[model samples]
Target: MTNTNIQILQFGTGNFLRAFFGSMVQDLNENGNNLNICIIQSTSSNSLQQLAAQDYKYNLLVAGFKDGQKIEQIREITCVKDGIRLPDEEEKFLNFAASSQLKWIISNVTEAGMVMKEEGPFEKFAESFAGRLTQWLYKRFQTIPQSETVVLPCELLPDNGKLLRNFILAHSINWNLSSEFLLWIEEKVLFLNSLVDRIVPGFPSHLDLKLKESDPFLVQAEPYALWAIEGPESVCSHLPFLSSDSEVILAGDISGFALRKVRILNASHTAMTGHGLLLGIQTVGEWINSSDREKFLLDIIDNEIIPTINLDRDELKKYANDVLDRFRNPFVSHKLSDISLNSIAKLKSRLLPIFMDYKVLIGYYPPNLSLCLISMLLFYLRTPEKIRDEQEIKLWFKNVSKSQSEIDVLKTALATWLDLEWNSSFENAFNKVRQ
Candidate 1:
């Protein structure tokens, strides 16, 4: 009998992938489709061993509001057919890779995970994440010449899938892999850009011991989830599971969706964390649940952020509303302190673009967003986070020559941080507000 389940090899046994993608696949499998997954953590760490002991069965507790009412469910995932830890089970991992049924190469190895550090021309299973993946794909290339491979990278980095493919190709070049194989990779391989959103606070220590005792590999998550993938229609057609899954969108152009997410949800986190801290708010849900803070965030996003995005206004607003609903989910207690870490860069990548755009197009400094930036600066200046940021920035905030020109200096510093040219008009509103 042929095992008809669509074979997928996933990198990372972490909480996010398990709770987000893992649970989703489990859902797809249970509902209608046959999607079996093989798990591998592409590192020396034997993290999947613990997962193996649980017989690859884990409890997923999804909690949130549905139709304006509280709802929660605990599901046991059995779709995980096998777990392989790299280095320890390298042969087994390759064996799984050699499967004729393998379809998509899904990964959540994180932003820094897809790096290429050149050690030798190409040692098998090279040290860096990109290299190891190249070696594995080469093995796949050799074993399964007929099968079409699609790379679905769930990492949050911009152009993640595109960059990942490029990295692999670059590695292949450095390694002097055959031009035929390289051309095969370029011509045949499908690298689909993906964006994943969900709150999976792993092994909830905060939950009561009785609840935790439900399953050894218990994972807690909010009901709301999104997996936006931009890929070819044929790619979507291959995996019939996505047809059943409403949450996993097969988007036409994922950049707009990615921009909306990065600019709004993620940007808001950067903009509001320090302010939320000021309000004595602990979790993201707590902050967004507060009517006052929620309105404030909404105004900023609705007014300043959404207008700039090229997507349909109605669709953007709908997404914004959904974002708020996700934020208000009581099940996920996303710590403000956690989000505030490495925040300067977060602000640069997230909110700062909106700021720059508003300045360029609207011809006015965005009051709410500017306030958030000022608040972020103040928060970092006063707290232990000051040391965590660059010394130059900290010192610039501290030792600006003219005390009266603080707003101008702050604006200039902000521009410099984002590599934008500073304009006096950008800080003029802040100056007026101060006066």
Candidate 2:
């Protein structure tokens, strides 16, 4: 049974947070750790009302492979004692946050949720997620000035914790907050950089219609999970749940883990996804299950990306193998169209770094990466029914008609897309794929 006491005040009710962090809390609760959750919806658009209807209890369906064998498990998450929405739940949020037991503020409101250009008014909480967090922090500070509140941001952005701290500081400045409150935020609040990995594709609408009435808030996820946090000795001491599970990695320097996981795991998806769509593959499992595409991606990882990564080779391979296992899970139907959203930006962040590094380190571009780049261009040119990417990028692709030489267009477009000098290596390799 979950403890009624609110020890964790989570800021988002998304699939990732609910599965990654909330599920872990469920573990803590089941283990007699006694800590419970109070989750606040990051935005008004969130379906928090649906969550509340279920008495804050939801089912986390974990399905994936381990050691080449299938595994399936379901956990009833009772840790989330309260599912809160803004405007209506503002007073409740303030009251719950003021609790001295609330030591951790776990958030997964997406990367964009970290930004707050301007925090409008104090009376009217700024609509931005960042602003909303700032308001909560202020209220918490007012309630307990010396309390050490650890904020774990599960967003995929680099330096997520530090960046969020800066945003909160900026909000404080814009709002003309008291120096006392500012000092408390700086001195007591702990924003530890973190990297979280788990594929939690929530409440599949197709399955939702067929699901039994007993479980409406059913969340599906891969069995593999990780929560790597960089912080002080206190972070380890406060979170005893870290030791009981192999999923949590608490360290002073989490950058190496971040780089390894984000690049090898996330970048693989980014690089292969557009190509998979071109190959008529609908989901990640479809791509990973196909021997040809699997080999293609594994070659890209070993030959191209791994050489540049500073992490140990054996560790990288193990993580890559784990990623492959997760991608092969039959239950999670991760759509390419969903992955294609902001794909241009994702490619720039995930794959381009490897391209730049590999080109500089080896004096030549890897053909596999080049092929993936060209395939990305091909997807843009074809423009499947699922439309994603910025208007500028789409319009650029739209300008290059079918009549234009695809290799030439790939060269022209990829150069501008990457903001790099047009390399003959990419063009030469891409032309071979064209032929």
Cα lDDT of model 2 by residue, 1-435, tens digit: 223377887877767777778778778767778887878885546578877878888888877776677877777888888767776766777676577877888887664455666655787867777787788889878877767888888877788899899888888888889998888887889888999988876765444333446776778878778888888776787666585453898888899888987788888887878778877787887778878888889998898989989889999998888788777777788777677766777777778888879989998877787777667768877774355765677777777666777666766777777775667767775675667
lDDT of 1 by residue, 1-435 (tens): 223353888888877788888877877777777788878776554567777877788888877886787977877878787777676666676665566788878898765465567846555556667787788778878887777787888877678889998998888888889999898887778888888777665666666646576566788787777888887676766555475443888867789878888887888887788677655677787777767888889999989898778889999889888878887776777777767655666776677778778878788767787777766655654453343354566676566555556555555666666565545544543454345
The parts of candidate 2 lying over 4 Å away from their true place are 1-5, 43-46, 67-69, 86-97, 116-124, 203-214, 243-246, 330-332, 364-367, 373-435
Winning candidate number (TM-score): 2
Which residue pairs in candidate 1 collide? none
Off by over 4 Å in 1: 1-6, 31-34, 42-47, 86-95, 114-120, 201-209, 214-216, 277-280, 337-345, 363-367, 370-435
lDDT of each: 0.73, 0.77
- The alpha-carbon RMSD values of the candidates against the true structure, listed in the order shown, are 5.3, 4.3
Model 2 has a clash total of 0
Error of 1 at 129 (Å): 2.8
Q: How much lDDT does candidate 1 score?
A: 0.73
Per-candidate clash tally: 0, 0
